[model samples]
Target: MSLTVDIQFKRSSKIYHQGPISLINQSVEVTKSGKIPPGQTEIPFELPLSPRSSSKTLYETYHGLYVIVQYSLRCDIKRSLLAKDVSKLQEFIVEYRPSNGETDEKKAVKFEIRPETLQNVRDRARIPQFLVRGHLDSAVFPLSKPLTGELTVCECERGISSIELQLVRVETCGSAEGHTKEASEIQNIQIGEGDVCRGMAIPVYMVFPRLFTCATTIAPNFKIEFELSIVIIFDNDHLVVETFPIKLTRN
Candidate 1:
């Protein structure tokens, strides 16, 4: 028995905007002509993702609350002169494919805003600033699947008092030990304080928490994003908000 192989790339955070970050360490030997008096043996290798700072093509395999990139294969065995040396490991995933008229693959995230433009630019903010809009039939979801949406309140002259829907989890973490956290899940589609309704088609259902949901990722420091907010509560105080960017996949 004589073997040796090591191929690795694991980066959750190390910081690199573009140049100088390579850690796909490589090694191979694999029991050349020795370890098998039995059966089954096949070893082939190829690992090269070199000097890549451009030509962007691979990054889609994520588990994020920060970042997570993984791939590993380690095996070392030797049974010779005194015998005693063995190690084995396997944990792998490196997938990002799109090359036939490549559009770079990642679609389904629609956007449209103007719920007071997330309110805060008030200078006596008026002029049709409350007609809401929202739609998310699919923004990539399958964490036990239940997120239907459609909220189209065509006009609001500061009448509706309650209509809030928020399911947010935006986490960002840096490697020098920086930290940020956000978690939310609130639901109440519509409920006026007295009696209010301008134009309505509101129907939004929400169910999120497969295992505390996570599937958006980006690394350098770390990032996790998922948002869906539409709060148009105005019985006169006027608080209109809008946001959308969601992906809670485990598919």
Candidate 2:
């Protein structure tokens, strides 16, 4: 038997900030086992951001700018039919909150989701069938000025599963001229389960090229906008997977 999973985003939302700020919002929708069926499930989550009083504001002087926002999806499964054993699955949680007073416009932020954790749940649950899939919508926004810098993403743990990072895609746009470009670049890197039980970090780096030719338009005034997409596949009789979007800016 094969299990199927489906995910979706209701709306491509945008957030605005100025002078020390914290924002939290949900950016995706996830559904499993078809539209509406037995044992089917749907989960919604929020992305949180908090400002740091110690950090300097991006627009202390005032300017218009924007940063790309990314969303992540996570799932955990546990073995054992016993309520106590299965209940341990609840303890396996994935939390994503902003570190400090960092705005999407000031510096690019990288977000990671654990794959091993989810696989562990499946093993504990003793489920014979497994399947996972993720989907994201297409949308973009303009942010208030004084954009932050670029972001680098590194995965620390393989978590709970025996899956590999199969695909990664990146997209970028010129801030001053709005010249947009996108690339599917996951093949450039090698992804594997470093140490099944201990977990490992997958590193991803992105660089934005400068487009302006004249000095007048180059007073540290060029901006690079980016979008990152990723996909993962698990080792099982059926397919198990996860995915999300990330946005960043280069100063």
Candidate 3:
């Protein structure tokens, strides 16, 4: 019996740019000899983890649009030539310990989202008059806690169909020549719907998914970042978006 530990960091060839690559592929012998006599059996073993190369380091497990970092463990048992070998594989998550240098301060950010403040609008003539005021609890968020905020629609000429909060992940892969950056939505949650009451505060909340996000990472070869978008869709299908860049840390 043997145990194999594999960690792969790859860029999707179909959706993104590069081919699949393996960063770490190593295995350890669990036991020199073993026999299974009964129905259910449990064996205990331990394996130390480290990257194969001296300069390489293990990154946290992350799933992104352009890049992916993953870890898995596989167990294999070799039988006679007539009997096929048995194997099982399972995925695992890896996270870094909170750094002692991390600060505990939380800074709130306030903003006003109006038609004039929308940056991505192609046509100003199509946007209706609207004013939205809000403040995020903090610009920096702990990965274990939920992102919280509140927003109020002070005035709007047209009715609203839905108000949504979207979490986006930005992944940058670097090479000797240059770097390619890709941004994709991780999750979107609707906080308000169907023309909500004017001047009434609407609550904003979102949980960071475990497998999809990690402490905003900046490495030599690649970088990972996150951003938030506040989308307001009108009844007539006209939409306005407000984007905010956020920092994520491990507490």
lDDT of each: 0.54, 0.29, 0.82
Writing each residue's lDDT as its tens digit, candidate 2 over 1-251 gives 11111111111122322221222222333333333347955555543333234322121111112222222233433334563421111111222332355433423333334444353345533333222222222222122122122212233222323343332333332333333333343332224342233222334332222221101111122233233343333343333343334432221
**Model 2 regions lying over 4 Å from their true place:** 1-188, 199-226, 237-241, 248-250
Report the lDDT tens digits of candidate 1 across residue range 8-54: 22233454322223344456664464756668867765556442344
Q: What is the lDDT of candidate 3?
A: 0.82
Better of 2 and 3 by TM-score: 3
How many clashes (backbone N, Cα, C below 3 Å) per candidate?
1, 35, 0
Number of the top-ranking candidate, with lDDT as the measure? 3
Sorted on TM-score, highest at the top, how do the candidates line up?
Answer: 3, 1, 2
On the 0 to 100 scale, the lDDT of residue 148 in model 3 is 96
| Candidate number of the best TM-score | 3
TM-score of every candidate relative to the true structure: 0.34, 0.23, 0.89
